[model samples]
Target: MASSFSDMGDNLDSLICSVCLQIYKEPVALPCGHSFCRVCIEKCWESREEDCVCPNCREVFPQKPKLKKNVAFAYVVENIVNVKKGGAGGTGGTESHCDVCNGEAAKRCVPCEILCCEQHLKPHQQKEHKLVDPGVKMEELRCTQHGKPIQLYCKDDGRLMCLMCMGGQHQDHKVVAVEIAHGELKDVLAAKYPHVSQSMESVASQLQQVQEEEEQTENSSRDAEDRLEEKRRLVCQFVNESVDLMKSEIKKRKMEKLSLLGKQREKLEKHMESLREGKSTMDKAFQELEAVSFLQDSKDLLKRLETMSHFKSMKMTPLPVLDFSKEEKNLDRLITLNKNFLEKIQKGPEEHPEKVDLDQNNLRRLYGRSPSLDPNSAHRHIKISQDLRTATRTCTKSQYPEHPDRFLYDPQVVSCESFSSGCHYWEVDVRSSSCWDIGICLNSMRRIGVESGLGENPESWCLEKHYNKYSAYHNKQKTDLSVPGDPERFGFLLDCEAGELTCFGDSRVLHVFRGNFMDPVKPAIAVYYDDDSVHFVHLVK
Candidate 1:
């Protein structure tokens, strides 16, 4: 029996101290009513890594606790140790004083809300009774206002409620039992888990796609920058090469001027030396000291003078004067070249000569012609410039005679030169207005009626603009052609042998029309309405 009791004591020792798990050694109590060994709890509280807390229940303290020894529990420990050593017997956990009689509590009288010894409990049980957990804080379990336990969870208000509140402020509110509300809320969370995960996955996928597009955009932008840089490098290289060529040409011209001038200088210097020698000999003969010497010198001097008289007259083919004005003019052409180069750049590489086998230089050199308007063929409403390069419309009337070839109804005019079976090209500057007409036509189209216009007649072929749109018209029929540049400049090339008429813009061929050549077609322009104007201009190569 004694051995069994010793084993029971060993097992009971675990209930002594929560910190060291040994018999209570100077046990101290916190305000939370949890006890631990003084030194162990103080050391734990001194730790800076964590908030001060009861070792067993983990109730955090706002400040470090001023530990006070549990005097009653210390006495209980003495009795417990005495009983364990076979000194005296005592009850363990139910150690409490009866509120009714001040004796040891044997049970709790829940009806009276008090603990009682067996002597007092027997009489208190006759009213009503229930046991409660000692670990529960009764003040927290009951409401401070009504002194009742919370029973319902208000769904609408989202708060815990006592039964009294359900009748008062929470009347008719959607509510459920606390346990049921907790269970349903947990179920709702469970139901939404997959949806939340799916939403996360969708967001992640969109982010990935955005990242990919961003990367592609960055790469493409970098490639564009690199290509532009390469083009810039090529431009700089061309500038350097052009400067070298210019220097070479200047040096060559300089050397040529030097050689021609050097020959002229040599001839002048030789002539001057001969004249100086003759003068020196003549002076010596004039100042002679003796007759014999004078006579001999005079004969030589006379022969020299006779030879000087017989010398050829000082003259040769006149050479050109050394000057750089023409070269300066050529250098000034650099500005025009740069302007044309910029125009080409604005048109882009699609129009560059490398795109097609057609040689732009050859076309310009072989077929280019200066164009002028013929006044006799112009309409009465039209005004022609003295230079015959420009034509414009007017609302006022004119007293000019209606010639045989004059356009009576339409403001149209013909050019001086015409082509029947050869190549011809010219460019028109149409920058003054948004609308104009330019084309080629047979010498005889019309002299009256609305059909007399350049594009309205069967003998005429033309390209025209109305606002921003451009189209080709022939025989009163029109076809829309793609516009590759602004309407400021339009170039035309006619290959009569091949029976093709081509339109050009921004240095690129735009359209080609083939037809049989039977008549000499003159370059023409029509500005019959809308205060329109047309110009035939020159481009300095």
Candidate 2:
């Protein structure tokens, strides 16, 4: 009866799943003839993208196969488990069963695809068959083509092969014993992994530090720019306030000096009038009175004459006047020193003295413009002065006949003169205007559309100011400018041959516009707000 139970237990072991090492629950067979629990096989192939392979045999399928439950196998497994639970003496087992008899397997013959007991292992030992502990796949231990035990490892193919395969298809391939190949590969990986892991950690730490430093640098740059802007605002305010204070002081001193001079002049005039009256009395007595009266009048006259003589005898020196020669010298020296320092700062590090001289010559010479505004070209809201040197923005329209060249949409005015060739230079006094555009435009630019505004169309390039901010504009594109000082006088240099138009503020380059000039260009100005005006400054040569 014990022997009968052992045989049944050995048969039951054959039904156990290799993946879970337990009796199959809801067994599903793959196309490779390998069976596993349905849930277990699905989980094993969950991460695969293209094809799934059978875990037991490593056979790849081109596509996912549909799972089919083995109902008969599931029923058999369930019944066997129930019977084993009901029985008093269970079937005991320590290892796999022998292929020949109902006995516990002691050794496995890989090439023969068999598990043997000590009783059945004698034949394999005598024949020198390779024996190993059980629980290995029979297919993996032998070559598939030759059906012989794997004895060699082919280095070129990175696969295991039998002696027959080595002598046939793998005859010229580099080969070694399977044991040697496995030991060497294991040693190589073990030696290299530590260094590679250390390098990766070091690189990761460096990258994190670099990212932190980059953020810090950007923050510092932003802070510096903010500080610079604040300083610029404060400096400009200081200068304007100082100038106003100085003007007030000069007026107060002049009033005090004039008051002293007026008082001294009134006293001198009163003394002269008294002396003239005394002289007239003496003359009337001498000419019209008798001898006695004349003698009495002479005595009084003599007293008066004595008083006049005393006044005449008093030493009279020039009155002390206010003098500013010493103050004026000191002021001139201060101005010269500050001007030199400002020039140096504006030039920056890249510009040299020679470059400054050349730039100055370019700006001052080359047919400088003192061109007057053309009344015919002025906008209705723009008031051109009689001299035509200034154009002003007005709230009311001017009473003038409409002309074809007039600017209808904007408060703009153009010069009477135009230049088609040669270098030209001009200056615009923009001190009175808070928002204005000073530039040159082609003579053919549109005069009736919104785009007719200076710097709004392709035919114009302008240095524009909105309140305190400045920008260079061309064809509706704006480039912001950083002008250091309050520049009331703006200089423009146009080199027709070089195709460049340069704007200057405080003798420093503000912006440059480049273009190919093929048409005559006239000076143009745009003013916004009532009372705003721009004057064409006449620069000397």
Candidate 3:
């Protein structure tokens, strides 16, 4: 019966799974006592959530049955498969049945797939064998290359080697017994892990510190930009306010001067009227024949003379005086302005400094300077006054020596003094000129064709006026200013540090330019049309 049960026949076919077509792996018995491999049934009924039916018996389970291995069936299958494969016996035991002797065996021949007892498994045997021990799981102890038990470990190759392999290819390789190699490797790993861990921790700490420093640097950059922008805002506000105050001052001076002159004219007009009345009276008396009429008119003329004499005692308006240097009120006003400016600087925007009026015509003299025109750089068509204070476009050319700086086409002249630092301002008196260009230009640009035109090249910046229209030019880009402006004067303000050039049309801001400028910017005047004139007002500081 035992032999029949162990036979590889129809009865053993029941152990095979229908799904895998292989011997049942972890066979389980369902509630209906129908058996199936656990993996095979799970895969087949995966779509069913509950109440699964057995594939073999078709018996429904209320809930998908929890599976447990069939221990008795597992034992039976193992014994049957083992016996058919020519193993020891149908029972579970450590001893093996030797194929040659049919007796208890001590070792199994790996390549031959047979068992061998102690006598046949002698040390001098040529066959490969491993000790059989059913009490413990068998570990891989044999080398694949030689089909012999692993006796040594080759450290260089990191592999196990048999006696024959070690003596041949592994002869020079560093090797030791397997037990010693395992123990040494473990000890080395234990010794180096602490140092590696410490190094990793140090690197992590330094990385954290570097990240923190980068954040701080970014914060500092943001703060610096904010502060810089704030400073620029304050500076711009102060400069604009100053221009406004200067404009107000110019208007005030003009009014006061005109008022004083008007008063004197009124007094003189009354005196003239009285004299005319006396002349009329004497003429009438002289016409009325002879000494009788003349004697009669003499009394009336004396009375008129007496009335005119009363006006003579009042002195003429003192030349309508408003000298900045001599006037006590103007000096006091300037002192107050300087004090306010200093206070604004010390206390910042919170000071809210009130605008202080200054001389309009002398605005540049206070904040900057207007240098004299260079006689050598003047155009032949430009006639400089004898005082070198005014320039006019002359019809006939003078026999002036030809200088390299002389204008070739565009009748332009440049200043002798150039400023590279600090704020500078100047006034240009266009004075009803039909066409003109007033600006600051580089000394290096001129004496040829279009280059002589102010703001035609990269080196020049100018405001152009022609035929009752206005336009500003810089780097060859023109901007129309719809503002016709007072045909008399314009102001220019240059802030070298701030890289700003501002043009004012009759005290109102006309155009502004932002850019870096080369050192020594000179004021320039260009006359492009007939009868056009431009002059730089002497800004006496």
Candidate 4:
């Protein structure tokens, strides 16, 4: 019995300190011979200034004893710690296992606050109680304020709630059981999953298409650059060749003129030499008393004089003055043409109007504007409302004072508002009118004659409703349109920056006209039938 007790006393448990409950490090013995870790005992006695005591035995000491290392006890403790480490596998997990089966815990019961193994989890789940994962804390499942299990979900607020929370802040909100809410939301997500996946696939396909288009654009840009370089080289070569031809022509003309002048100079010099020789002969005959020689020389001298006089009287051809007027005019024309060509090149390609397919909602939301009719611009037969928002054609022309700005021939009216740049949108309630022309036109549009009609000249573009038929007209060119139904209102979008005039009805684009809109344009309306009217709608942002 003594041997067995001795062996038991030497076990690993005997090396643990009472205060730390860990294997001793730097073990020290007290006066009562009780052993503990040196640091643990020192910390435990720190509060007891006068009565320091042994933690395990509670043996009293009047004064704190000076601690010294118990070398043999520390050596035993180090050996026991190493043995304990070897017994435990090197696995670093610290989670506790089920005490019943000593196996890994599968689930934890929140209400019972117990961990269960697979064998025990079934019975616990059969009770229909909340079973969380082993890693989930019981505190997390409970409400922070009420300290109760969450039972309800607030549908309005979209959050989980306990029973107490449902009665408190979430009482007014729509509340349902947590399970029901989860299942419903999951079903909704499942139903929408295919559509969402299809949308994602479509977006991915579009991305790939865009990438391929970008690659094609890059290749086209490279080809264009090469073509441009070749054109530049050819132009330079043509210009140099032309300049060389011009220089050659100028040199040929100059040589011909010089050759003609040289021949004329030689003939005059030969006639002058003949005159000098005749004068010398006549002087020598006069010095001699020889009548025969004098007579002969005089006759020759007279003939020479006659020839010289005839020659002096004759007209010489004038030196050819190079006529550069035609060349000058041609060069001026070429310079003008070159300047225009360069200006176009500098401006690059014409800006094609952006084709936009926007519904009524987008049109109103993005570029909505309110423009009232201008009574001053209304024709005599077209009566404007008091508020200047409506225009109606009457049977007899009104006796309104004549104004230069008023339309003289056509029963038309222009809006008070004008736009020169940027985008603007407006709508006209034209359901009351069967035959009407609605569009935009420059302020300088003709005020007299049939040319003053909307869409009949270059200054106007309009969508005309001739009774039941519909057509788009601009600059006297008409295009027949296919309309599905009788539209109540006509929406007009003028994108001046893009130089586009679009008319839409019932969210469908009827027609689009594109041109250079250098000057400001105003909305215009033409009502041909008596009592036919159109109203300018006030758009809301």
TM agreement with the true structure for every prediction: 0.33, 0.34, 0.34, 0.39
User: In candidate 3, which residue ranges exceed 4 Å CA deviation?
Assistant: 1-365
- Model 4, span 1-541: residue lDDT tens: 1112123443658677888888788888787878888889988888766789777778888888877556556654554454333322211224757646879887788778988898988877899868865656677777788888888888888887788896687879999998898678766656665565465555555554666677899999999999999998997897788778777888988999999899889878977787787677667766978787677667766876777676666567788886667766866887798899999999897553233456667778888998988877899989998888889989987887867679998999999888876788899998789999999999999899999999999999999999689999999999999988999998998888779988898878899899877477999999999998999898997
Ranking by lDDT: 4, 2, 1, 3
All predictions: root-mean-square deviation over Cα?
36.1, 36.0, 40.3, 31.4
**Can you tell me which runs of candidate 1 are displaced by over 4 Å?**
1-356, 528-531, 539-541
For candidate 1, write residues 229-344 as lDDT tens digits.
99889978977787788778778888887888899889878877778889898888778889988886677788888766644476765766656677567657966888999998
Best prediction by lDDT: 4
Clashing pairs in 2: none
lDDT of 3 at 185: 68
lDDT of 3 at 96: 53
Candidate 3 per-residue C-alpha lDDT over 414-462 given as tens digits, one digit per residue, 9 for 90 to 100: 8877866567788878774778888888778867886568888888899
Best by TM-score: 4
Please list the C-alpha lDDT of all candidates, in the order they appear.
0.73, 0.79, 0.71, 0.80
List, residue by residue over 397-435, the lDDT tens digit for candidate 2: 998796779999988999998876567888899889989
Candidate 2, residue 85: CA error in Å? 99
Runs with alpha carbons beyond 4 Å of true place in candidate 4: 1-152, 162-167, 171-180, 270-315, 318-320, 344-541
lDDT of 3 at 180: 91
